[model samples]
Target: MNIHEYQAQKILKTFGIKVPYSILASNLEETVYAAKKVFKKTKNYICVIKAQIHAGGRGKGGGIKIAKSIDDVYKKSSNILGRRLVTNQTNKKGKLVNKVIISEYVLNSDKEYYVSIFYDRNIYKNIILYSKEGGLEIEDISKKIYFQKIDPYIGLQEFQIRKIAFHLKMKYSAFNNFIKKLYNAYIYSDASLFEINPFLITNDNEILAIDAKVRLDDNAFFRNLSYKEMSDEREYSIIELEAKKAGLNFLKLDGNVACMVNGAGLAMATMDMIKIYGANPANFLDLGGKADSKRIKKGLDLILKDKKVKLILINIFGGIVRCDIVAEGIIKFFEKKNKINLPIIIRLEGTNVNIAKKILNNSKLHYYYVTSLEEAANKIKVLLKNELRCFI
Candidate 1:
């Protein structure tokens, strides 16, 4: 799960990594007080007011501002707090900023660098991605990045540290210590990604993480209970939160077709088939191995919540989950709702397929049923084409 920058900085500090003195605030008065606290603690007049959100590119989205005085801090914090911050990583609607971090502003840094550690799926090992050029334009200069892979079992090596330090022309002693501590922090935290952009070397020769972005592996949360508190439910939509509670995997998207499938791989294939047939998927919903009546009803309710959804596609390959159970759930849902405005397309195979088909055929609900993937694809193409024709 992704966390705010302030929380990431706090985690870094726990690992003996140096970061700018910062205070978290939720309002104008608190922001002003936090700025005073930072200035006094750091003995610096200038402080930075940064909006706390899960996405990056906050600086370009007017979420980061310089505060030279108490009044400046108040004004800047007022503007950021409660504002919807739109960044490249976020949607057009943007994310709401309920908190801001007021930090000591470092001026005239000797150098700015980008460093990140993440698991490389291709090689099945963790790798360090670093670059001499850092900042907001890192995306444009990605070709300049250097990748160094670390052995999962052996951990980071001394030679790898020296190679990166030499490439960046950094002092060996300081760089070595900083990298080791950072790597340890990443491993200890069970972080999927630990990034420090604009890693600063102050004029006083101190290494500091100016900006931090951390994402922890959700699967590893059992070992790190403290990290669970860092989760912000405000970052997720109500539907997504509900899905999580119901033991389902659901992600909302911007399209017209809502998909409900049994497995992750099949869900992906369903989405691809939708796109290939000249339609877009509205959401990714995985019903898991147990597609019971309650789960099916919950998934359908979640799908209907999105007003953008124009069609519902239920594709289930019943291995452990019975297809008849799924059919019963769909019929029961429509019975309670009395009416469904959107069209439903269902394709069920394996495990009581005949029984499931018989059940669905007897239900009097208006739905298109297909027997094969190829038939489903054709049905989707015709239905979506007809939908567009009606819209036009």
Candidate 2:
């Protein structure tokens, strides 16, 4: 699960990672108080009052505002609160700003740095990432981070820390402390990935982790009460929450076609084929490798809920997930709903394919089943064309 910047800093502080002084505020009164507290520390301070939301690209979307005074802070916070913060990285509705983090910003820095740890499913290892170039325009920066193997059994080592520190060009004096602090933060947080972008070395040449982005393993949520407490009400869509409850990996996108696949790799391939077929997909819904009848129905329900979905495609290349199970699930879904007019095309292969086809046929529901991938795409295209013509 993702967390706010203030909470992330608290985690960092717990691990002895030095961060800028900050305070969390929810309303206008708290924002003014936070500003007063920071102002008391130093006048003419470069202050920043940022909207605390789970989404990114805040600066580009005016969610991160600079405040030169308490008045500026109040004004900025008022504008941000009660309004939706729409970033390039967020959905159209955007995340709500129930809280804001007020901080004393760093004055001057020529360069920035970033360190992150992400789980590489392909490699089956928790990978460490560090880059010298980090900050607001970080995406533009050349990705030259160090990657070290994380042995969950043993945890972080001096070797891995040194590798990241040396690569980041950290000062000789502060290298050891920085590495130790960052490593500790990574382990203690129970985080799948920890990111500190623009981990700054100040004008006086003091190291500080200016920005923190920690991605905790969702499975490990029960272990970390602190992370759980950081959950915000305005994180995701109702559909997203429902999808999670229904045990489906559903990501909403911009298009007319909604897709469902049985595996991660196959989901990606289905999306690619949809694009190749000149139709954009509205979502990426993975029903997983299991052929649980209930899950299949839930997946279908999630996709069909979208009014933009002109065509729904179910592409299942069954391995452990049997085609018959999927067909049975589909039949059950249709029976319960009584009727659905959405154009659906199914491409089922692998285990018990014939049995699946027979089950679908027995249901007497109108659906196109093609043996080849190309045939499935052609059928979807034709369906889309027919749908558009009917609408026109």
Candidate 3:
């Protein structure tokens, strides 16, 4: 649902927002060509080369650089293109940089500010937050700021834009246009979150959105086919992509205990219990309230694909989904694969629980069943301790 900065800039342009003149290029020669074109138009020898990746904090990880000359553009692009970019939001392993955005670099920016519009789930309203202190994380956002909660039914207004601009001490001529353009882009783009970090104010009284980050709502994917094509599979892991294709919600974490649960609520509780028991979850895979044999097999396969998983924990309190059906799927999956030594723990309750326990009891696979959440935690604690012994 997230897109690279160049794509975000395209969306901004569609709404008449001003951004730096730029070109997207995937290779060294293309990068130089893009810079040359920008220099010709803007007559600015200084160009910026940015690594195109989904995650932010790119500047902190050297994914962004300023090229003062054409030679600098080629050199920086070559070093960045094929490298794996690591940022604070991304894992230590980083992501592959397949392309770079070359743009005209602006100079003599008098001030920087942070501006973002996002839905505040706590209050279920869209919130617009901005601060003169730019290039800082949310935690570091300055107390001198503006937080406006707008009703989507009313849309944006001229006064709202003027207020923000006035507070930032922006020039009257440019602020009105900049604010209207950016707000309209957010409204029309079906964006879940839109942010412009370091929205630059140049000495020449021009406003420029220096960096943009946009995330689209997944539920609205059907409405925007163009946005779908902009999605990069390289943003996800192989297992993550496969899990998504299988209609499962999966996230890989830096832990060893693999969690399998029937609902998002239970999945969260299971992960919390794991932490309470002094263990970390390797992944979060929600099977939902419904599961068939194929889904069960796919879930198990996905769990096993994670090499960090030292123990598999299944927690099911069936409501719409029958526990017996889930148990049968689990047994048959292990039976077909003949996986007898894998460590699996289960806690089942509600909806044909008796039959489900019986099915699991008769299976040849090594599955430990518990009666309560506390017992499940204890079991995981014991198993993980023994697992640690093997490596130690």
Best by lDDT: 1
lDDT of predicted model 2: 0.80
TM-score of 3: 0.90
* Residue 331, model 3, lDDT: 82
Candidate 2 or 1, higher TM-score:
1
Compute each candidate's TM-score over C-alphas.
Answer: 0.92, 0.85, 0.90
Scored by Cα lDDT, where does model 1 land? 0.89
lDDT of 3 by residue, 51-112 (tens): 99989988889999989788988888888999999999889999999989998887745578
Per residue, candidate 1 scores C-alpha lDDT tens digits across 18-62 of 998889998898998898899889888899999999899999999
Give the lowest summed-lDDT range of ten residues in model 3: 383-392
The count of residue-pair clashes in candidate 1 stands at 0
User: What TM-score does candidate 2 get on C-alpha atoms?
Assistant: 0.85
Backbone clash count for every predicted candidate, in the order shown: 0, 1, 0
Badly placed stretches (over 4 Å) of model 2 are 41-46, 124-128, 143-167, 202-206, 317-322, 336-339, 372-375, 385-392
Cα lDDT for residue 196, candidate 2: 82
**After best superposition, candidate 3 residue 342: deviation in angstroms?**
4.1
